[model samples]
Target: MRSFSRLNSMQTKLTLTFLLILLPLVSVSIFANYYSQSIMNEQISDRTKGALLTTLEYIDQLTQNMDQQTLLIASNPNIVDIWKGIENPLSPDHLYGIHTVQQQLTALTNVNGAVKDAFIIHGESGNGVSTLKGGIKWPDVKKDYWFQQTIKGSGGLVVYVPTRESRNPSLYMSEDMIYYMRLLDVLSSTREPNVMVLAVDKRSFQKIIQNLQTSINMNITLLYNDGFVLETNPNSENLHKEEPFSITVKKGEWSMRLEQPREEVFKLSHILQQFTYLITAISIMLAIWIAWLVYSSISKPLQQLSGAFKQFSSGNLAFEVVHQRKDEFGFVMNGFNRMAAAQRKMIEDDYEKELRLAKAEFSLLQSQINPHFLYNTLDSIYSVASSNRIPEISEMVINLARFFRVSLGKGRDSFTLAETVQHLMYYMRVQQIRKDHFTEEIELDEATKELQILKLLLQPIVENSIIHGLEQSPNEGYLCIRSRIVEDRLYVEVEDTGVGIPEDRLQEIIMEMDKITSKSYMSSPDKPTSLYYGLKNVKSRVKLYYGGDADLLIDSQEGKGTKVTLILPMGKEGHT
Candidate 1:
């Protein structure tokens, strides 16, 4: 009884090991079968459609050529003159003229291989010339169906595809001939207008379908006006079944139909499916045998690894697997141990860095208190100056306090366009008090006033413009701050008519700004200061807040002026 219980335990383990290997093999086989069939279906459908399109284009070209030929013959001066002069069909004097017209018609049929025969018929007397039967007299030609149809067409070209019984006996053309007819009214005579007809051979269209069939091994049917079957390869009526794979493409009045048997199209995929089943069966049998042989060796190590993985997933990054034998499993276990140790170290290092960053940010917040204190002191001084009735001191102190208050942003990092512009005004007012040489103008779009932007974003740019651009000029300078929104981006331009930057210095500053705003510079510990530190600081902050889409562009000319444009993206919340 104890031996039977042990045997049952062995059976359960073997079954589990076998199933673990078999399930994935079966799943892969199933996926491969489905994917291969899908690919084959798509490829076959695309190839068939492409072939049908090619055939349609060829047939359209042939029909167009036929129409052009009919137009060319109907308007021929020689044929028009001779046909009009022929008053008597059997008269000796008019026989030569009729012969000339017949010769011209014969030449047309001989030149173009697609034209089987050409004819010129008189509308009233039913007497005209034919390429096949010259100087023929058909007294009832006016009563003929094609002639009456052409006359009713009112000079427009008409095409006719004749059945077997309706083939023209006078021209001796076959049933496969299509007729293109038009009234010869190029030169108006007193008599009824003559009719010009050309019999086009359908073999040209048949040849195109045949060529396509030879390459793709499919049946093709050419239809005229989606109704009449002009030609079909293999000459079989029932070869193209509606239930099978088929495609139809129409061009103008002509269309092409392509068909292939479903079984024939998917023959290769069926073979692949069969082969896959065979492979899957053999793999399952082999997997069961392999599982039996290696179960004892792999069972314990897999359990150890699985347990270690569970612990590691449950926040135990220090978990490791121990194995003595140096096989594939041992290699995996050793890799897991090293990976765990590396992961634990990475987490520790990241935590330490985050803690340091938090402390630094706290230190920065603590440092801002002094600026607030200064702002308060300036406000108090402004009040004192107001009480003493010193307007100049009062204005200066108020502007200074407002500038520092806006710079601090009340512990917020963003403000509306109005507040931002108001902050810059405070700074500029303080500067104007010191030096009144520069004239300032601020033009902002009313629609852009509510757009939230980074605090103090424009202050440093304006400062650079006034100090470096306006101050260096000899005459009175102009400083203009304009704001507009274009294509969902806010554009702010600070234009100064002062001594501009030299080309060399501007290029140097541009290259330095590029370096400062780069990812590598942001990650580095050392960041050197530059003469254009304000501009660099603006570029860096724009890059940090708005990503790479925001831009700071400086266009300058020595002694002319400088324009610094800031393009900021208006994100979903109206701030970036």
Candidate 2:
């Protein structure tokens, strides 16, 4: 499974794709190398064979001319008659015949350049007449192996490589000379016939082989009757070591063999093969490089994009794919970055709007409470004064004046815990005048008193305790407002002993506040009723002003009491 997954990776896929494209080209290159080598081998063989045949033809022509010359010398009427008459070559009577035969042999040798000498031997007397050694006696001729063989054989024209002993000493004969012999029976009745022998220099044949060798760059070997004759290249031992291309041509008793080294013959093919291999290697490297480039260009960006998407889905709006390319991947990455930025901006804008709306709602609630509370307080003061000049009326008026003065706070949105607590005491004092059944207790930690808090943050909770918690109770109620610092946070609690809230009503109030916390307070078409409306307002104000770091929690029990705690983080100012 791991291997298969790796194969599916971008780098692997790119490599495989490059290989797929390269496969056919590499195959063609290899096949062409093989095919070209085969063609070169065949061409070399055919061409070399043609050259060998040409050399053979030249050699055959020389031998054929020599043979014709030998035949002509033996069949001459004078030579034939002289041979028939030459029973004793020491006699003066036949000296003329022998001399005449010598003249003919001389002419025969002179007529052909390849034939260095010619001889006519009398088979019966074992004597011969040579162009070089004229009037040879029977004993002198009989001592020659050529003469002995010619006399013993029944033959027509035959070529021989002469032994050193068989060469005529009188003539300057070379070892490279060949002899062509023809037995003549001009006297048909006599079985003892004469012979005509022509000594041919092999230099002419060597010249022909050398010319062919030079033109074709090959080694040429001439064979006469399967015997070593001459070779154009003497250092052909290396040619035999390795397989070589060879061609043989035969003409009569002579055969020509042409040899060329296989490497030399297919040199072009070998070069092509090497060139193809080099090109293949370079192409493979280039393919890998291109695959790597593609992987870098495509795969890396895709992975970035994939990761960005995951982060975005997980609510990380700041995650962005970074790329510098101007290709498609770059375009996609840029789009992704724009999308994340746009989404982040949208969320921030929505949050800002929610904050503004909540602020406006809090201000409106504060505005409504100030005027209406002043009217009620003034009326209550009127009632207290009209009924009696009570000390309570004086206290209510002073507290109401102080409450209004502190609630205004010179347009400040927040105040120190001490100032906010002092404001709360003034409001509770006014409430105490209205409802004497409740008594208030205020305890503040010095640490908390100096901490800054949102204005009107505690007032609504104390009002709720007085109006809803303490006002309904027939007996005496207690109200406690306390502030403390705990865990780097400011905690202010308002506790009351009164009728308290039923469990179901408390749950309803909490659910309503939760709804406002979860969504924008102004999202609802209708405003909250008077029931826990001040608490809802405080909840919304706290959420908007302090965000999640501040909260309002309510605890209540039937006929027991109610408590509302405001939690605010230290060292953080509430949002206006």
Candidate 3:
């Protein structure tokens, strides 16, 4: 009661209120000056550094552009091919090669105005082609510093200043010039070691720093590796006392900095300090009023959430969700409170079990076999066919590439029958090319082509027909694939005129296909021993997804032929 009386007393209350207002105001005055100055300095630092980085990025991009331009010319198969013709330079093919190179360089210059000229300096012969007024050949440049630097760069790029005394200096003719040099692209593991130069004006970089300095009241400087100043924009102010903030430009030996005037930097902080005094009395009155509002709006929720935060920080999931509906504070409170409420309600073991189940399901999906071996085999064939220049072989290779691209499910898991037919068409073209051992035919109704199916659905079935069936036959084989919609059901059939399965063996396939309906899942421990690697695999999946609506029918005679029929429900089309 005595403590309560003391708090209620007017003298005590006024005294407490007076200290609360005066002490903070005094501290705020000093703190505001320091804090404002710190913030100002920090903002200037970030802006200056950001501007520096932007300039550096532009320069780096320009260098990369120049490098790309050089590669385009140096790797010009025409230029490399003409090396034989270019040995004499006066030969008809050499002149043609030179003319071709000139056209390429001229096009490059027309596209990018930043580049002055693109040239290739031959390593051994020392003669080369340049874009300066068409093409010009030069004498051996074994002693040139830029050429020496190119060799030192070791196929990478090097940026250097072109001097008046440097070789072919008159070609650039300008005082402000930068030379980006690199060795030629090593073709077929053989280092040609030719020098490629891209001459650009140094002003391209200076203009960047100049553009930046217009907005900022600071002096900027770009320096080379040996402390030589490359570019600078100086602001007229006392910068002697202000140490410049420095940043290193990546990819090259370069550095840049911004020097801010001490006076301009602290200008706002001084104004904020002076205004602080005028608002002291106003702030004191505001403090008394805000104290009452804070207790109701801020204090209670903060206390509740603070405890909850402490519980969370301590790794204990024992806290109630705050349920306030007043303001943004209430939104924050509710989020925490709901989490605390959920922590108590959720079943821990069940949640972990759910996660494990999801992961196992995903792992099962990821483990499914992909036809990469076929891709590698096709890639090898494509490479050989491409080099051999065999038109039929190349066509087969390209078709096989298209087939795999569609079957691999780049991302899509389902595609229309049109795409499926296109894939099959490529597969048949490839098999027909390898050897005309089989006459392949495909028939698909225009209306039924829009129906969708799983990727690589018919590949294994068709592959088996080609390999196991026709490859064994002494006579030319015949294979037919037909797709159509009938009686509101999608029917696909593969018929082959090759050695067919016996009745006993056909029954085994039927039994294997039957087990798919009972298992529901695709993979089984019995899968290895069973002959389900291809046909049964497909049948199981179709049965699993379509249930009783899907059917796989197999019929054969030991000497005549084999026919496999696949029936899927009509509504399964365009599932994705």
lDDT on C-alpha atoms for all candidate structures: 0.76, 0.74, 0.69
Worst lDDT run of 10 residues, candidate 1, spans 361-370
Q: Residue 32 CA error for candidate 3 (Å)?
A: 3.9
Candidate 1 overall lDDT versus native: 0.76
Candidate 1, superposed: residue stretches over 4 Å from native: 1-145, 148-370, 380-400, 414-419, 429-454, 474-495, 503-555, 563-576
Query: Which runs in model 3 stand beyond 4 Å of their true positions?
Result: 1-31, 83-93, 133-140, 163-175, 215-217, 223-229, 232-238, 241-255, 273-576
Candidate with top TM-score is 2
- TM-score, every prediction: 0.42, 0.44, 0.37
Q: Judge candidate 1 at residue 72 and give its lDDT.
A: 80
Choose the strongest candidate by lDDT.
1
Candidate ordering by TM-score (highest first): 2, 1, 3
Model 1 TM-score, 2 decimals: 0.42
Clash counts per candidate, in order, are: 0, 0, 2
272-333: candidate 1 lDDT, tens digit per residue: 89998998999877976776556557565666877998999898887778669688779988
lDDT of 3 by residue, 516-575 (tens): 662345334344234557786677556655657788888888777788888888886333
